[model samples]
Target: MWIVSALFAAVIAIFAQLTIPLPLIPITGQTFAIGLAVTILGLRYGSLSVLLYILLGAIGIPVFSGMSGGLGIITGPTGGYIIGFLPAALVMGIYLEKTRFTSSHAIIANIIGMCITLLFGAIWLKYFANLSWPAAFTSGIAPFLIVGVLKAIAAALAGVVVRQRLLSAKLLTTKTVSH
Candidate 1:
């Protein structure tokens, strides 16, 4: 599980490079990675995975977006969004674990997690970047809405499929009954 979690964190780092840089926050595939991780790893390990990823980035390991890292990056304008990943993973993991891991539930969990991340990121952007609410929304949330939804759907489908496969192979287990 630890190996898998670290690998997923590395997957996030790789996706982070797939970026479209914006004025404030770049659009990247990290969110997809987050959704995939939470849906696949479940609550306990998913949260740990995200937490480990954050710690890696915080220690200047260049695991963050754009190959950047260190406390400065985390404390920078976009840091809030980065920090928000933890809670987002935790919430999504918990929500998904408590319910059936169907496509619908997965999508909803991802959406809720995405919202939590956006909320934290936007508020942090407002304060850290010295931007107003509208400005923060424009920079942090607005541009990503459509892409976010698409990512959520993709994550749901992929997570469910992969998890089912793993469970069939006896490589994974879930609290819920076998689907």
Candidate 2:
């Protein structure tokens, strides 16, 4: 069951990467998936699923943003953002599991995940792009904030919806069996 969930999330991530490409950094729904994935899969498998997606892209599977691939792609200006996904996914997964994925809890977890992604992205961009803190904030974060916030909201809603759906299904199944 866990494996199926992981595979489902991974497939969604790959499709999201291919379909959604931002200007320099692709605006992926994968981050949203990362939140929901972790909420559903928990920490260990959630992180592993993200790692699997990255590995597939790194090995020339064209799963990166805008169909970008290879090791060099990861080391580029956007590399930090790509690398950020690992910890972001892990943090979000663990946080969501701990909170039990209520709407409020999902909101908090989603924001934390986005912040972690931005933090790692900013620091890495500072080194790779050679930008100052202000510059990095201006370029690396400022542009993405609006869209990132939307993504976080969407992720949180998705998390709550999926959780409710699963719980309802489980309850229905239980009642049917009891009858």
Candidate 3:
């Protein structure tokens, strides 16, 4: 499961490295995948999944966006976000467990995760881009909200759908056994 999560997350990370025209942060769906991973895998596995992704990248695997890798990726403008994934996963998992996969819980958890990751991402952007605080927000935190919300919604939908499917399958099995 851990390996699956890690490999899945790494693929998402690489996919997420795609750039959209945002002055603050580059657009990527990796956050969506991260949140999805947390919701699905829960805390320990989720956090490890993201952590392993960073480690993989740092080890020079071309698993990051733009096919980039190594420790330098973490030291670059987007490094904060890379570093932030673990804590973000942790936060997402905690909320998932406590909220039990309700929509409200998913939303709140997602927002918190987004904020934390953005905070780290912005700080790293500043260090690398040599931007002031305001500049960082203007450039790094401003343009990603729409996509983030979309991703969260997708995660919620996936959860609801998956949950129902599992329940339905279990019911069918139980019915068959009773006959």
Off by over 4 Å in 3: 21-24, 163-179
- What residue pairs are clashing in model 2? 22-26
* lDDT score for residue 47 of model 1: 76
Per-residue CA lDDT of model 2 for 1-179, tens digit only, reads 44645584466456466444445555666677777666555566667778877787788777776666788878887778778888988787777666566777777878888888888888888888888999888777777788778888887887678656765777323222111
Model 3 Cα displacement at 27 (Å)?
0.7
TM-scores of all candidate predictions against the true structure: 0.94, 0.83, 0.83
Q: 26-143 in candidate 1: lDDT tens per residue? A: 8888888889888887877777778888899999999888889999998998788899999999889888878877889999999888888888899999998788999988888998
In candidate 2, clashing pairs total 1
lDDT of 2: 0.71
Of 1 and 2, the candidate ranking higher by lDDT = 1
Summing lDDT over every window of 10 consecutive residues in candidate 2, give the lowest-scoring window: 170-179
Of the candidates shown, which would achieve the greatest TM-score relative to the real structure?
1
Clashing pairs in 3: 17-65, 24-139, 24-140
- Model 3, 80-179: lDDT tens per residue? 9988878888988887776676667777787788888888888888878898999888777777667777777786666546544544666322222111
True-vs-predicted CA distance for residue 109, candidate 2, Å? 0.5
Error of 1 at 132 (Å): 1.5
What local lDDT does model 2 show for residue 86? 88
